[model samples]
Target: MSGNKIVAIIIVGLVHLLVGYALVTGLAYSATKKIIERVTTVDIDEPEPEKTEEPPPPPPDEAPPPPIVAPPPPININVAPPPVTVVDRPPPPAPVIPIARPAPPAPPAPPPAVSKARGVEPKGQSRWAARIQENYPARAVRSGTEGTVGVSVTVGPDGKVAACRVSSSSGSDVLDEAACDGMQRYARFDPALDDAGNPTSASWSTRIVYKLN
Candidate 1:
C-alpha cells in the first residue's frame, strides 16, 4: 500500500482512542456527581411550643352554719319550809286487843261402815305355808324377770288346799301360772277358827313376793 494510506490509518486509530477516553471520563464524573448529591443531604429538627398552666376556681359565696350549744340551768334556790304542829299522842294505843284463836276443827269424822263378817283367820303358822312361796320359774329366773302374784285359796273341811286361782296377775304369765300350781300342791292349813271355836272352810288371799337379794 502507499505511504499516505498507512499514515491516514494510524491517525484514524488515535482519534478513536481519544474519543473513548473522553466518553469514559464523562460517565465517571456523572456517577461522582450523583454520589455527592446523595451524601450531602441533612435533616433539621424544629423547636416545640411552650405550655400554658390553668389556675384553680375561686371559693363559694355562702358561709357554713354555727354549731349548737345548751343554756345554763336556773340558779339554785334557798327557800325555808313551813313549821310542823305537835299535839300529845295518847299513851301508845291500849295494848292491841288480844286476838282469840278459834278452837281447832273437830278431828275428821269416822267413816260410816258395817262390821266385817267373821271368817276363820287360818292359824298363821303351818307346815304347808312355806312350800307355797314362789319358786322362780326356770325361764323367769334366767330372764331376770320377777314379780308378785295374789292368790285366793279354798281350804277343804279336811284342812287341805282344795283349789286356788290367781286373783291378780303377776306381770309375767309364767309366774302367775306357777303361783296357782304351787298353791294347790303345797298349801295346807289347820281349819280356820270361828267365833264358836269350831273348824270351818275359809279362803285367804296371799301374795308371794319373788325378789332376788
Candidate 2:
C-alpha cells in the first residue's frame, strides 16, 4: 500500500507536470503563432487610410440670377402737319361806259368888199401919213430942179413906212437930189393883213413929185 501510494503520487505529479508542460507549450505555441502571423502578415506598405473621395464640392450655390434685363421701350414721336393749300380766285368784270358828242357848224362866207382891189390902199391915210406929207421937199421942186434917187424903206405890217433912206442917185443930178429929199421927209402907205386876220407885211410904190410951193 505504501508503495502504491508513493507511485500514485509520483504518477500524479508526473501528470501535473505533463499538464503544466502542455499548458506552457500551448501558450508558447499560441504566442509563437501570433508573432509569426503578425510578422508575416504585416504589410511592409501600410494600407493608406481609406481614401474617402471627397464628393465634388457641391456646385457653388448658383448666385441668384441677375435680374433679367428688358429691351428699352420704343420711343414715340409726333408727326408733322400737312402743308396748307392755296386757292386762286378769278378777277371781277370791268364796268361799261357811254359817250356823246356834237357836230360843229360851218363857217360864214367872206364879204365881197374884200375881193374888189387886192393891192389898193384906202383913200384916208393914218395921221402918220399926213405928218409925212407936210414935210415934203416943196422948195426944191419949185425951181424946176429935177433929180432921181434910190431909196431904201422899211414897211410895217400896217402898210406904214417905218424908215426911209437914199442909197443911189439917177443921172439927172438935180432930180436925184430932189427925189431923195422928198422921199426921206414924206411917205405914206396902208397896212396889210394875212388870211388869218393877223397883221402882215406888204410893199408899196410911190412917185417922187417936185411941185412949186
Candidate 3:
C-alpha cells in the first residue's frame, strides 16, 4: 500500500529469484541450501519506535449572552395644580330681621292743653333789699368769708315766701345757709300771674353778695 512497503517486498522477491537461479545453475546444492537456511534463519531484532507525548484535548466552546440595554427615561410633562374650593358660607342668617311695629294710634279727643306763659314774675317789696345785709351771720362776718350765693325762692299765691333753697355755692356753707334763712324770714312777693291773669305759685332765682367792708 505504501511506497516503502512496496520497495521492501520487491527486494525480497529478487532475493528469492537469485537463490532459485543459483540452484538451476548447478551450484553446490547442500552448501547453497545451508547458506540460504542460515541467512533466512538468522533472527535480527528491529529497533523499537520512539515514544512521543500526545497533546491535551481542547476545551468545550460556550458563547456569551447578548448585552441588555435599558429603555430611555420618560419625558417630563407640565401639569396644572388642582383648583381651590370656594365654599361660601351662608351670610350670617340675615341679622335677625326685627320687623318694626307701627306705633299705637293717638287718642282721638285729647284734653285741653294748659297755658305755660307766665303773665308776670313775683316782685319783692322795697324793704326786701335792706333785709339782706342785716341778716349776715356773726360767724361768717368774723371769719371774713365773702362770696355770692344764688338761691331759688318759691312764693305762694298769698304773696309770701314758702320755700327757699341755695341754687349755687358761695364757697362757704355758713354764708349759703344764712342767705336762705334770711329770705324765708323777711321776704315777701307779689304772686305771679298765669296766661289767664290768675295769681299762681312760682319760683324765682336771686343772688346775695357779701363783702368784708
Candidate 4:
C-alpha cells in the first residue's frame, strides 16, 4: 500500500510541471511576434506647418499748389510849350523938301445962247407900255420871266424912233435885247423943236418894266 501511494504522488508532481512550462512558453511566443510586426512596417510622415506672408508698405504724400497775383495800370503825361518873344526897331525918316508946281489950264467954255425961243417937247403924256405888252416875245411870256431894262433912244426929225440901245442889263441878255428891238421897231415920237421952231434929232432915255400881274 505505501508504494502505491508514493507512485501516485510522483504522478501528480509531473502533471504540474508540465502545465507551468506550457504557460510560460505561450507568453514568450506572443511578445516576440508583436515586436517583429512593429519593426517591419515604414513610419508615416506628418505635413510641415503652413507658412505666413506680410502686407506691402503705403504710398508717399503729394506737394501743395502755388498762389495768384494781378497786374498794375498805366500812367498819363502832359507837357506845355514855351512863350514867344517880341523885338524893337527904329522909326522911319521924314519926307524930302517940298517942290512947288503950277495947276492945269481951264477948258474952253460954250458960246452964250443967242436970243431965241427955247426947246420944246410934244404935248401929251404917252402910253408907251401898251406897245411893249402887245408885242411881248412868246418865249418871255411862256417862261414867266420878268425884268426891267433902261434904253437910250434917238428920235429922228420925222418924229420916229431911229435907234435904240440897252444901257443896263435886265439880268438877262434875251430880255435886254428884246427891249431895244421892240423900241426901235414899234416906238414913235412927236419929236422936239429947236430955237427956230424946226424939227430936230434928240436923245431920250426910257425904262420898260416887265411884270406878270
Instruction: Using lDDT, give the best candidate's number.
Output: 3
- Residue-wise C-alpha lDDT for candidate 4, range 111-170, written one tens digit per residue: 886644433243332555567656676787799888899988888888777888888778
By how many angstroms RMSD does model 3 differ from the true structure? 35.8
Reference-based TM-score, model 3: 0.42
Could you tell me the TM-score of candidate 4? Answer: 0.41
Distance from true location, Cα of 127 in model 2, Å: 9.9
Q: If scored against the real structure, what TM-score would every candidate get?
A: 0.39, 0.29, 0.42, 0.41
On lDDT, the stronger of 2 and 4 is 4
lDDT of 3 at 99: 90
Q: Largest TM-score belongs to which candidate? A: 3
lDDT of 3 by residue, 1-213 (tens): 999999999999999999999887766777789898988897789999999999998987888888899999998687788998786785566567789999999879977768755632545555774687677889988888899999998888887778989999899999998888888887877788776667888888888887777
In TM-score terms, candidate 1 sits at: 0.39
Candidate ranking (TM-score, best to worst):
3, 4, 1, 2
The true-versus-predicted C-alpha distance at residue 65 of model 3, in Å, is 99
**Candidate 2 residue-wise lDDT, 111-143, digit = tens:** 655432244253344553455334545554455
Question: Per-residue alpha-carbon lDDT of model 1 for 19-128, expressed as tens digits?
Answer: 99999999999999999998887676788888978787887877778877788888868867789778787456666788899999999989975544355355543555
Error of 1 at 195 (Å): 7.4
